[model samples]
Target: MSATIHRIGGREPSLEPMLSLVAPDLNLVNAVILDRMNSDIPLIPELAGHLIAGGGKRMRPMLTLASARLLEYSGTRHHKLAAAVEFIHTATLLHDDVVDSSDLRRGRRTANIIWGNPASVLVGDFLFSRSFELMVEDGSLKVLKILSGASATIAEGEVNQLTAVRRIDLSEERYLDIIDAKTATLFAAACKIAAVVAERGEREESALDAYGRNLGIAFQLVDDAIDYISTAEAMGKDAGDDFREGKMTLPVILAYARGSEGDRAFWKEAVAGRRVADEDFAEAVRLVQASRAVEDTLARARHYGQRAIDALGGFAPGGAKDAMVEAVEFAVARAY
Candidate 1:
C-alpha cells in the first residue's frame, strides 16, 4: 500500500498528567520491576532488558498503582501487585511479538528477532512465573485468583486469534470476545486488584473492573481504527498489519459486511486465498473510506470510552479520579 498515513481526526488527550499523578507509586513499581527482573542465569535479565528498556508507557502497572491510590489505599502491597501487573503485561508483549513474527517493539528490535524465538518465549515464561510468585508472596487469595484467571484468559485469547488466522469472516461479536480476553481482561484485573488490596467491597471493585475493561476496549478500538487512518510514523509500525495478517479487526469487519458480493470475493481472495498483492491494500483503503469504516470504529471506541468514564461516577472528584478519566480520553483519542 503506497499511501501516506493520516493522523486520527480528533484532538488527543495527554496522559502526562495521569502519569504525573501516579509518579511516586510508579517509582516504587519501577523498583520492584528492576528487582524482579534479576536472575542469576545472566541471559534471562539481558534478554528481558532488551524489551523493557525499549520503553513504552508501562500503563498496566500504572493503572494498578493509580487505582490503589484512588481508593486512598495506605498499605504497600499495591507496589508488589503493580509489579506483578507489569510482569504479566511484559510477558504478553513478548509472546505477542513471537506470535506475530514481529521484528520491532516500541521502535526497537523485538526480543525474538535479536535473541531468537526460543529465548523470547522462555524469558516470557520466566516473567509469567515471576508474576505468579509476586501474587503468591502478597498472599492475597483474591488477587492471585483474579490475576491467574486473567493470565489464563490472555493465553486463551492468543490461541483464539491463532485459530482465527485467515478467517476474515470473523464477526464483530467474536472479535470483541477475543479482545476482551486478550487485552481488557488484564486491564480489568489491574484495576480490580486495587479494590482487592484496598479491601473495598464488591461494588467498588466491580466498578473499577468495568472502568478498566471499557478503557481497554476503547484503547484497542482506537488502535484498530488507526490502522486505516494513521500514518506509519504515528503508528510506529506499518499500517494494514491486520489485513496482511488476515486478522478481522473492526474496520475490516464493517467493510466486509457492508461491501458488495464482488467486494466480499475480493476480500476472500486477498486473505483467505492468500494471494494479496499491493493493489489489494490500495483497494482496501478505498473500501474502508467508502464504507466509513474508520469512523464507525472510532465511534465504537468513543462509546466504550464514555462507558469507562461513566464507571467512575461513584468516586468523588479528585486527582486520581480525574487522571483515570483523562486516561480513558487518551485511549480513544490516541490516534488523533
Candidate 2:
C-alpha cells in the first residue's frame, strides 16, 4: 500500500508547538537507540535500522518524554528509558508479524515477510536483549521491575489471543483482558517508569499510569474498529486479515452478540473452519454493520479516551497536557 499520513479527526495541531515540546528529548533518545543498535554484525544492524527509521508516529517515546516533563522530571535518564520503551515496542511488532503471518505493516512489507520468519524472530530477540541492555545501563531496580512485568504480561496476552482465535465463546471480558495485557500494560509502564525516574511518589504517578493504560485500550479498540471497515488500500494490509486469520476482534464479538441465529452459524462455519470466502467477507461486513459493532467500538473508545483525559486531573492544564488530552479525543473521534 502507498504510504500516507492519517490526520485523525481534528484541525491538526501545528507540528511546531508539539515538536518543540518533544523534539529535544525525542532526538536524544532516538540517537541513543540508533547508536546502541549499531553492531559488528552488518546485516542485522542495517535491517534493524531500516525498520526503526521507517516512519512510525513514535507515540510511545513521545508519551514517555512528555509525561516526564509534565511532572518536572529533570533527569536525563528519561532519554534512555524512552529508548528502551521504543525497543520493546519494536520487538513486539516484529514478533507480532511473525505470529500473525502478516504481510504489511506501517504501509510497507512486514519485517517477517521481507526478511523471512526465522530472521525476523531472531532479530526481534536481539532487540529484546538490546532493550534489556539499555535498562541495565540505567541501574534502577524499579525500572527493571516494571519493564520485566510488562514483558511477561505482553507474552501472556499473546498466548491468550492465540487460544481465543476461532473460539465462538470468546467474551467481551476476555477480549478486553487480552488488549490490556498485550497493549495497555507496556503503555502504562512507559508512563509509570517515567514517574519512577523522576522520584515522583505522589498519587499522580498512578494517574499517569492510568492515562497510558486507558489510551492504549482506546487505541487498540480503534484499531479493531478500523480493521473490518477499512479497505486494504487505506489500511496498508488486507482488509479482512483478521477474518482470514480467524481472529475474533471487537467487531466480530459485537456482531456475534447481535447476530441472528443464521448469521451466527454462518460466522462459526466461516471463521472456525478457517474457510472464509469472498462471500464470508461480505457477510462479516453485513453482520458487523447490522450489529452496530463499529459504532459500539467507537462508543467504547470514547469512554476510555475520556477516562484517559480524566486521569490528568492534577496536572496543571496547559498546552502540552491539553494536547495530550486532546490527542485522546482525536484518536477516539477518528471512529467517525
Superpose all Cα atoms of candidate 1 onto the true structure and report the RMSD in Å to 1 decimal.
4.4
Q: Over the stretch 130-210, how does candidate 2's per-residue lDDT look in tens digits?
A: 989989989999899988899889989999999998898899999999999999998888888888888888686798899
Clashing pairs in 2: none
- lDDT leader: 1
In candidate 2, residue 255 scores what lDDT?
Answer: 92
Off by over 4 Å in 2: 1-18
Model 2's number of clashes is: 0
The residue-level lDDT of candidate 2 at 113 comes to: 77
Q: How many pairs of residues in model 1 come into backbone collision?
A: 0
Q: What are the per-residue Cα lDDT tens digits for candidate 1 across 1-336? A: 121212223445668867998898888888888899999999899988887777678789888888987899988999998899889999999999899888666667788888899999999999999999999999999999999999999999999988987887788998999999999999999999999999999999999999999989888989888877766667766667777778888888999899999888878886774646667777887888799888888888888888888899999889898788888877776766
Where does model 1 exceed 4 Å of error?
1-12
Question: Quick one: best TM-score, which candidate?
Answer: 1
lDDT of each: 0.86, 0.83
